[model samples]
Target: MSPNNDKETPILPWDHFSNWVHAICVVTFDLELGQAMEMIYPADRELTERERTNICYLAFPDSNSGLMGNVQFHFRIRQCPQSMNAHTRPAIHTYNSNCPTSIQIEDGYLYGYVYFRQVKDRTLRRGYFQKSVVLLSQLPLVSLFTAVLELVAPEYFETGEASLEAACHHLDQWPPPTPATTLNLPLLGTLIQVRIPSRQDKPGASSLTPPSPTHTMSGPPSVLIPTPHETEAFRVLAPVLPHLNLLWELVITAEPLVVMALSPTTAANTVQTLVSLIAPLRFSGDYRPFFTIHDSEFREYTTRTSAPPNVILGVTNPFFAKTLQHWPHIIRIGDNNTGSPSTQKHKLKKASALKTVEQKPGVYTKYRPHLQADKGLVKRLLKGVQTGRPVEVQSALLRRHLLELTQSFMIPLERYVASLMPLQKNISPYKAIPSLRPFNPDEFLGTLEQHGPHLTSGIRGDWEGLYRRFFRSINFSAWFNARYQEVSDKLAELHLQAVCDADLGGWVCSRSEVEVVDMVLRLRSKLPRAASLPPSHPARDKLTQHLHTLFMALPEDLRAVLHAS
Candidate 1:
């Protein structure tokens, strides 16, 4: 049953994806105010001081690629702005420039999906044309939103307000965030057919495969996460490829990891990809794709002696290299100056063996990768790049390889977890509830000798070493707790069932006379029936009949006292 609390779960009036897009604001860099929202289309109502401040600040990212390029980032509003009447917030309106320079969130959920761009231009006084197209919504659909922005933002930059108005209206026609359904969204002279993942779906549960033949769909799906399109996936994974094994361990163990990239787009996307790597087993940890110095907990996150445990932060600014130097695990990606006469996308310069004073651009880890890298997979990826294969095909290759690798380890864990369930008959209400037997690493590893990673994957090495270390991590603790609680709750439910189904009459009769009296009184305490009720409740009647049976079997003196009561 859904909770009755309105703040926790608002009853939204509008149901489509269009309705969730509450505002389409354009943020620009002003010499005076660091960032300001200049235009808000269909200015439905004036934004209060708090709304303007937060919207403008978050709309434009704190840092950039340093080079001219379009970048993307997401902003999370802890609460909605006060003026946003949740029930009426249907279409997104741009932000206004009414002298206010800050923004604040309200009491509900909201997010800002921004497409920030910077370019060297002679017309602008700052010697750069800096602006961001922001879509304010009640959800974060990064993969889909990023794709849409890639198409809309450049045109909006060229056509200005007119383009934004058309795009916003077109987006207004988009359906709600429904998973397992195909959608054809029309915008800017193109009809796009794709199945988008639901923001509500757990990671790894969102299927990328074509629907089974028995399941019909309108058409094939398009680029999705866990495996993004070749360019984005390559950009995200390439910088960390040499340390892929180490990175995987970090994510698997749910360690604190910070990704430093030149672009917030890359930083945030990489964070999202990291969480998705070990899909099916959700990463039960906190993560921020783009962490801003202006965020409320900026001090807590940056100035802290250690990065928050199991928290992943992606930051773009070089300043973080020094600010977050104390962080234990970091992946700093190489920046690609895309516009610098470089036609090739994925080229790399030699990585510094240590963190750079400015922006270190490689995996920063002393942790050894227990497993050997699959030279075959690396060869395939490099061969495709050398031969100039389609980015989608190459991205798919990496995606498939990673997916298989994840399954190789996860299957055994699933089997082990299932094996832990106690037989229903073993559950007893009269005694201590049974527990899932402790996980003995040695015993479990013994099973791995037969059905382990080597049988399922081409990549092979110290699998035992990997699992042993994993048992010590907080990731295992969380995984165990979640599964343990579930099994414990099931055991409780089974106990109740066993109590209800037991031969209460025979069991009670076998006990001493004193225990029978106590047991009857205890059973009666559970039946909260009013004496005023007309003599029958199914629950009360059963207990009454059992009492009568006990009375007939009881000593005459005890029966007389029970009958009198």
Candidate 2:
């Protein structure tokens, strides 16, 4: 929308730095430069010094690696305006969908999908190879983008830039990344079918769609999330499944939590999955799926005197066990290989001290969950697996229960908020505008006098205390603020339309001297357009001549109102 931007420039899906993706980067460890970004794909994206430095560092953030294989993880980086081409301005994915849900990006952030690898090689002087294939994008579909990289990065590892060119060529043939629609995109001679979820869609309300379906269904995109709970993210949660209710409480309440796992992939995926738990409700806390000791906020996050910030960190280094000990909650995880290949099993227990040696996984927390765990659900899952039920269905079962639990907790609040909308007759341009009713915790509780929030998951208890606690939480604040802004905008639009529709002469005749002056002041810029109209016209005469006469006729005492405003 800037005057300097080239509006006529056509935006293509594989433009190297298009809206779908910003760059396909290759970051490598140099002999002297430490972590370095060796290539910016398409070779046309000339990044600023700040952007280059940030991508090189943030894309491959870990400072210590104990393994010599590829470990895929996700991270977010600060967006640099100077590094962006004008065609990359925020806009719809395409003109065809007419879908209003575009990329939901904050002011200065970009999602990074990284496939970091370390391998043994004799060709290098260090006798080892370290590099990462990075996909930088503005979209928030972490699972979708990571899956795309999985199919593309393997070939790039072997053929280098030629693979990227081939990938980009194929990417150009694919459809735009539009939400609320199912896209059948072709990549490396394979068709990837995924349905992007809308912000309004609730989890568990629709069937879970796998990445590769047995047959393509024809129709509008199903109402669902991009990825199901039947992913590695859920498998990572297996270690702490028994403590899930507590995990939900901690996450929804915005408490600082850490995901500890032996594999960086597990740690990062778990963190991202936890962040996505409050689907339809945005997470407003800082999170680092892949945290490093040398990160910019290391000192601030680990200082002994400070209370732990409301954040989520996924760490592989054993050093965090001692460093983040003072943190409120910790969910330690282990490899998912405790039993047969058909089942996912892991060991975890409550511990006074974290396992510093990085062996088995365990939960270390003193705070109790508000609602008791739904033990029956766990039993049913185990029972189903015994009867040859698809174990993959277990994640969906747990996922649906959690979604319903969250929705139940929010239903009363949502109902109460709906009542805050002013009666249509109460809104008028001639009168002082009214805003949505103020949110009062005690008053809000009065509406629940007959009954408290009911959980569809069947977990029950006195959750009044939890409701009170939620009003003070960042999640509540964020959700309420969003509602408040939405209502405020509605009121503003109504007022503007009403004012525009009102008769100018009749409106002026009913106005006070001060109101007349205020209206004239606001209309000064528009007066020229009215003057250009035919003199016989109603709006032209009233808005130009009659309004000017009324404003000029105002007393000196009333004219002072203009100076004050």
Candidate 3:
């Protein structure tokens, strides 16, 4: 079916017209100023006159009937005087008669207005005025017309250069407006509106006024825009410099000269390869290489031995080698022996077995010192081997083994000491000496009896001798005197009630003169004397005995006051 041929072209909706304007503005701004559409519009709102003018100028800087012409036309339309008889009915004029429709004079000038009469209806029409009136009635078309005028004569709006190329070149210098920059344009709009002159005067005076070219919109306060130099600086410094310094440090430092392997097969092959490479350099004594099959033995060796300040090589199971890598001095040999799946499984089982053996409580106890002594000898041997002088590495190894065998005859005292350390705190001076009572020998004996099974015969005998010496060396008299003096000072500072509350089990006795004197005073102060009872009564004697103990702890000089009471 054919479409309706008689229908007029549908007028574009207002929203659609606004959208088209916005899209054009976006492309124009992006090309000229390197900014996106959102950076300018940000939200759906009416564009301010200045914003519209700027957009127009940016879009069609060279057009003659662009933004400036539209603005001028609108200004002229608004400034035109109101017609005197505009509210009255239209006057009819016949074509046969030659007559003027209206006449007026202004500013000493006379003017006549004529209307063309249509013969069919004898209706009069002012063609130019009516056309303008019709144009004004269609608001959407008016907006479009202004937009077209803005494109056609943009130079008429712009105050500066008419050359589009020059304007484009100047726009190229501006950075793309970020979201932060767009947010502040409203404030700039408000300031520009305030500065604009009123509409009553000639529009040309304001038309020539241009916005400041160098004025910059301060971006949103919270938004930070990094400069190109800062961005480049972070890029160069963030990832690259630390790695460069690390590489430099590694290259400059001397380490990992000697390699030790734990597996016999791997160690022998590694050492042989190293010897083949190092023996040809005729600079050193025989390099005493160290290797061990046991992981526990290797750990013990490393723990007791300190290597010289030179690079060293170490080879071990994959897991142990990972730990050695953390040490800056050791250079590890990688395992290159490829085996079948079954063989690899066997290797894993063997490594697990070695780890289990190393973790066993008895293994550490039995082998720790032997490993310690061996490691010390190996260190000395390695130091000597580093010199140019010839030395027997095998002989030193033999001596280390022989020394270990000899030392086995003597029992290890370290286990005995470790067992005794916890017990030592219980019997320490601060804990044992603070009591007012005399020291008990039973506690020490009980501790010895409990820990004696863990010690060797030699250590047990030595411990017994030390225990006896500790007891004999303690001066009980001095301890008692010190306690007595401390109590006396405390009593001298305290009141009679405090003295009555004190514990005086060890130092207090009825026969002591100081005790009797101090107690009598305190008892007399706290308890009133009965009129009928003598001081020697049973009740008085009991109170006097208690007071004596309290009084004995007072200072000797202060005891004189009790004696007087």
The root-mean-square deviation over C-alpha atoms between each candidate and the true structure, in angstroms, is 9.3, 6.0, 43.0
Per-residue error (Å), model 2, residue 422: 2.3
Number of colliding residue pairs in model 3: 22
Off by over 4 Å in 2: 1-17, 44-68, 79-88, 92-103, 172-174, 200-202, 205-233, 337-352, 355-360, 455-457, 500-504, 510-512, 519-565
lDDT of each: 0.63, 0.67, 0.28
Q: Report backbone clashes per prediction.
A: 13, 0, 22
State candidate 3's TM-score: 0.14
Residue 337 miss distance in model 1 (angstroms): 7.6
lDDT of 2 by residue, 1-565 (tens): 1122455777654542364666788999888998888887767756677667666765563535476677777876555677554443534324212322222455456677888778899999978888888887766677677777887888888888888888877766666565556777677766667765555455445433554343435432322334522244345555566667777887888888887777667777788778766654567777777776656567888998979898899887778888887787787775552312222333334545554534555677777678888888767766765686654576667677777787788888888887898987888755655788888788788877554476333677657777877777888897888788778867765654455566666777666776776666655544554554467755554445644565566777665765475
Clashing pairs for predicted structure model 2, backbone only: none
Q: Per-residue CA lDDT of candidate 1, range 79-175, in tens?
A: 4356555453212221111101111112254667788888898898899898998877654456666677777889999887888878877776776
Question: Could you give me the TM-score of model 1 versus the true structure?
Answer: 0.68
If scored against the real structure, what TM-score would every candidate get?
0.68, 0.81, 0.14
Across 498-536, the per-residue lDDT of candidate 3 in tens digits comes to 333444445354346654554454456545532124655
